[model samples]
Target: MIYIPKMIFHGNPLSFGQYFYDVWGGVSYWFTSALSVAQILLAALFLSQRDRMTFYVGTCTLLSLLGIYLRNTLPSPFPWYYQTGMVSTLLMSLGGVYLRYESRINKLVSKPYVFGIAAFVYLSYVMITNPAHPQGTTPDICMYLWKYLTILCSIICIIALSHLLPQAKWLEYIGKNSLIFYFFSGTMLALFGSITSLLAPDTSYILTLTVTSIALLAATGIN
Candidate 1:
């Protein structure tokens, strides 16, 4: 009802990183190398039998703190995206680990089943409430399908991992924070983008990106 556009074409306005890239000629695309590394590290941590949760939690917290610092001090072209991606991947990875390691034999209802059901319901709600109708450019059907697929994959991974691992408190904590971090990060990006647009209307995209990245980095360092 808030006139939210479909995330595929119009993209989500609340997603600062996405919006920043859209406006700055896609500068953030270059950082995918770093993001890919981070993703791999997180996924590996989840899969490993070693003290994986401890390492995962420490890394996630560090990155999140770094993101906050960067937001304040660095001249990032797309700080929001970087921060959100860092946090999201961490949480998702932790969720996967938790799904693998949490105990269910002692409980009547398993956590993975509950989480899977909840995620499914939420996805369904998004699909039904989506304002875009058939073939609308704003919310392409493929985008919706992709979202569902990602969620499904994540849920399946969690379920499978839970069966394999059987105990990981860090994953539970990370999963709890993931939702909160996602919402807050989106809001922060929108606010930062609006401020930058208003305050530096004539600035070149490169300069803006650089300055923002610096500011974000500095902020992360300080906090």
Candidate 2:
């Protein structure tokens, strides 16, 4: 992420400099890495101290946002939704951890067609309103609300789908082999992009996306 932005977009001169320069070139890398680590810690904490989940989630969330508020954090440019995403992802992480343990909510949401319909309707509503991307100079409260609700809806829909789509063996195969796919995919896509640029830089956006998706799937399928 940091490398692409620096090397490709901003064209940072220090991209090939000393290793320390590469890291010090931007705090975004550190912040992004730290946020990922924070999620891991929060997940472990949530799993261990289920009784105090509310406090843990609230504290983790507030601490993350408080840093931005205190420092007057700036917004990331296009293609990087870190500003609002920083908070939304954490909230979603919390939701995922809570869902793993809370059978009551899962059972409630997993009801046939309820979650499926709810997820569909909510996404439709979002598409209707051209909500401004939240990771901008001015954040909207609705964006936060939207992400919060959407993550829950996604979880519910997944549960609903498990009951509805289990007969699809390919989905099961993909799920079983997901880790290997995740590991090799980044390099495969980067390599594919380089190849594309050399052959044809002005490839259509649709074609680029389609090829990228296909390449990623192909990368995952390899032994």
Candidate 3:
């Protein structure tokens, strides 16, 4: 579908290699994000072994930091290992494993609000100071740092907020179908151009957001 439009409208024919890379090779993170749940379950097998669990988490934490550092420091077009999101999967999956035991950690269970507020504030600070920019072929170290901090902080905030709003059925429904929304979101975004093309070139961001949201929900529902 993507290839046909570029060839017909843009008069730019994408080679098979390019199309494969664009659609699959470069986007391993999209799939790995979901597969990380499998990794979480495997890690849970060691729940009874305290020493091994601590070692695994500690090692993954260090590897996560190392992966971030290497990706930032290395030349453009990072190695397949870095691009495949192995480090990120380990980080997130291990974090999930740790969260299973969070309730037992008296400090975290007792003062969840404090941690949540701190995460919110730090996330706000990063958003303000390190405003996102397009990550080109060779992005800066700050871009890598910004992404890591934003993800970690966002996760913390979401986990904390989940405890407070545990009974929102609407939210639960949305969460249940999040993957469906994710899968079709790009198609909706591409379709959005038809609506935007009818309006002024400099349409407001709100209009784009509104139409995209409606189109995505409609697509999800139809699917």
Q: Supply candidate 2's per-residue lDDT for 125.
A: 53
Q: Who is ahead in lDDT, 1 or 3?
A: 3
Deviation from native of the Cα of residue 90 in model 3, angstroms:
4.5
- Residue 191 error for model 3, in Å? 0.2
Query: Considering TM-score, where higher is better, how would the candidates rank from best to worst?
Result: 3, 2, 1
Worst 10 residues of 2 by lDDT: 76-85
Model 3 CA lDDT for position 172: 76
Comparing 1 with 2 on TM-score, the higher-scoring candidate is 2
Tens digits of lDDT, candidate 1, 55-140: 66777766655654554566463532455355355555556555666565224224567556656765665676577845445343
Point out where model 2 deviates above 4 Å: 1-37, 40-51, 64-93, 96-102, 129-139, 167-187, 193-214, 217-223
The number of the candidate with the highest lDDT is 2
For each candidate in turn, give its C-alpha RMSD to the true structure in angstroms. 18.4, 6.2, 5.9
Q: Please report, as a residue range, the 10-residue window in candidate 3 with the lowest summed lDDT.
A: 75-84
How badly does each model clash, as a count of residue pairs?
30, 0, 0
Task: Give the per-residue lDDT digits (tens) of candidate 2, residues 33-130.
Answer: 44454555566666766675566667667755653553344554222223433454456656656666878766777776677677886786567555
Instruction: Give stretches of model 1 more than 4 Å off.
Output: 1-51, 75-80, 103-223
Assess candidate 1 and give its lDDT.
Answer: 0.52
